[model samples]
Target: MLNYSFPLTAAIVATFFAAGLVKGVTGMGLPTVAMGVLGSLLSPLAAAALLLVPSFVTNVWQLLAGPQFGMLIRRLWPMMLTIVLGTVFGSMLLTGGRTELTTVALGVALVIYATYTLLAKPLGVSPRWEPWLSPVIGLVTGLVTGATGVFVIPAVPYIQSLDLDQDDLVQALGLSFTVSTIALAIGLVWHGAAPVGNLLTSTLAVISALLGMAAGQVMRTWISPQLFRRLFLIFLLLLGLEMALHGLLRT
Candidate 1:
C-alpha cells in the first residue's frame, strides 16, 4: 500500500477546494484541477481515481440545476456512445506496468491540447459542424479521459468554440461533465480500479471540492468570462508543463 502523509493530505484538501470552486463557478474544471494537483503527489492512477466521487456528485448537481434534460439527452447521446467505446478500449490497457507510460503520454497530449486552446482563435463554423464535430470532440475527450483523468481541458475548447450563450454554455458544461464523469467511473470499475479502500480519500477530496465550488460560485459574479477563461487556461498550461516534467523525470 502507498503511504499518504499529513502534509500531502492537507495539500489534497486544498486542491479539492480549488477544484470545487472552479467547477461551481465555471460549470467545469473539477477533474482537471483535482487530477493535476493530485498527479503531483500521488501516482497518476491514484490521482485519476481521486476524481471519481467528486465528479459524480457535481455533475449530478449540474444536470439537475436547470430544465435542459431534453436538450442534454438529444445532444449527449453520440458523445456518450463514443465514451462507452473509449472506456472499453482504455480498460483493456490499464495495468501496473503501463502506468508510467500512460501518465507520460497523457501529460504530453494535455500540454499540446492546452497550448492549442490558449493560442488559437475560435473557428467560425456553421451549424452543420455541431452534430458532426461535437461527437468527434467527445470521442477524443473520452479516449483521453479513459486513459488518464485529464480530459476536461481539451473538452473545454470544443464547447467554448461553439459560441453558446452563458446559459447554454453553463448547461452544456454541466451536462458534458456529468456524462463524462459517469462514463469514467464506469470505466474505472470495469478495469478493477474502484476498490473500496479508495473511498476514504475520495470522500475527503469530494468534501474539499464542494467547499471550493461554493467559493468559486461566489467569486463568479465578480469576474468577467474572458478573464475567467484566460485564468483557467494559464492554470492549465502551468499544470500541464509541471506534469510533463514530473512524468518524464520521475518515471
Candidate 2:
C-alpha cells in the first residue's frame, strides 16, 4: 500500500481540484493539468494511476450531456479503435521503467499542445480527408497518453478541425477523452501500475474534482472565458517548460 503524508495528500487533492476547475470552465484540460502538476512530484506511471477514475467519471458526464451519441460512434469508430491499439502498444514504455523518456515525451506533448492553443488559427478539415487524417491523429494521441497520462494534444485539435458545431464539438471531445481514459486505465492495470488498493485514493481524487467543478461552474459566469483560456494556456506553457528541462537534465 502507498503511504501518504498529509502534505503530499493535500498537494494531490489541491492539484486535482484546480485541474477540475479548469475543466469545468473550458470543457477540457483535467488530465492535462493534473498530469502536468503531478508529474513534478510523482512518476508518470503513478500519476497515470491516480488519474484513471476521475478522468473516466468526469468525461462520462460530459459525454452524456450531448446528443447524437450513435452518430458520433459510427463516425469516429475507426479513430477510436486506432487509439486503443496504439495505447496498448505504446504502454510498454511506461511498464518498462523508461521514466526519463516518458517524462520527456510528456513535456514535448504539453509544449506542442500549448503552442497550438496559443498560436494556431481555427482549422477545418475537408470531409474527404477526415477518414485518413483521423486515424493518424488518434494513434499519435494514444501513444502520448500511454507514455504521459495526458491525452489532449493532436486528438483534440483534430476533432476541432472537423468543423463540428458548438454542441457536436463538445460531445466529440468528451467521447475521445472517455476512450482515452479507459484505454490508459487498462494499460496501467496490465502493466501492474494500478493496484486495487489505489482505488481509495482515486475515489478521493474524484470527489475533489467534482467539488472543484461545481465551484468553477458557479464562477464561470463571473470570469471572462477568453481571459481564462489565455491564462490557462500560459500555465501549460510554463509547466511544459519545467517538465522538459527536468526530463532533459535527468536524462
Candidate 3:
C-alpha cells in the first residue's frame, strides 16, 4: 500500500483534483474517479479515506443549494435512514485484509454502473410504490457501498427512476451521495481505514477537488453534456474492465 512521507503530496492533490473535475462536469462520480486513480497505489481503504472530506463538502453544498431541499428530504428520508443502517450492517466487509475482494467489488460496481447508464432504458416508479421500494434500494445501495467504497450503482439508478426534473435529480444525487459519504466514513473508522491520522493530506485534497470542480464547470459550458456523458461511460467501462482483470489475474 502507498504511504505518505509528506503532509501534502502532489499525487494526492492531483488524484482528487481529477476526481473533482469529473464530478463537476457530470454532477456525480468523485469517489468512483478517486478510487480508480488511487486504488492502484494504495489500498482501497486508504484511497477511500483520502476522499472523505472532498466528497462530503461537495455533496453537502449540492444538497443544500437545490430548490427541492425540504420536499426531497421529506420524500427521501426513509431511503436515507435505510442507507445509514445498511452501511453499518455492511461494514463487516470493510476489514483490513480484504483488499482483493474490495478491488473486485469496486471494479464490478463501475462496470455495472457504466453499463446501466449507457444501455439501460429509462425507468419510472409510481408514487405509491416509493413508500416500500425506496428503502429496499437504499439498503442494497448501502451494502454495495460498504463492500466497495463506491456508492452509485443502484442508488443513482433508483434516483433516476423518480420522475424529477434536472435540478431536482441533481439535488437528489447530492442527498444520496452525502449520506453515503458519512456512512462510508463511519465504516472506514470502524475498520481502521479512516484517514484521521492524515489530517493535513485529507484537508488539502478538499482544496484540490474544489479547484478541479471549478475547471470542470468552465469546461461544461464549452462542451455538450450528452457527448461528455457518453465519453465518460466508455472510459469507466474500460477502467473497470482493466481493474477487474488485474484483480482476478493477481488472485
Choose the strongest candidate by TM-score: 2
Provide the RMSD of all predictions against the true structure, rounded to 1 decimal.
Answer: 2.5, 1.3, 2.1
Window of ten residues with lowest summed lDDT in model 3 = 1-10
Query: Candidate 2: what lDDT?
Result: 0.86
Give all TM-scores, in the order shown: 0.88, 0.97, 0.94
Model 3: CA > 4 A from native:
1-8
Q: Please give the CA lDDT of all the candidate structures.
A: 0.72, 0.86, 0.83
Which residue pairs does candidate 2 place in steric collision? none
Cα deviation at 227, candidate 1, in Å, is 2.9
What is the per-residue lDDT of model 2 for residues 1-251, given as tens digits with 9 covering 90 to 100? 14677898999999889989998888889999988988878887778888888989999999999997889999999899888877877788876787887787778778889999899997888999988988988898888888788888789889988878888989999999999999988888788878765666877799989987887888789998779988998888888888888999999
lDDT digits (tens) for residues 109-208 of candidate 3: 8899999999999999999999999999999988888877788979998999999999999999999999999998888777676755554467667888
lDDT of 3: 0.83
Highest lDDT model number: 2
TM-score of 3: 0.94
Please say which candidate is ahead in lDDT: 1 or 2: 2
Clashes of each: 4, 0, 0
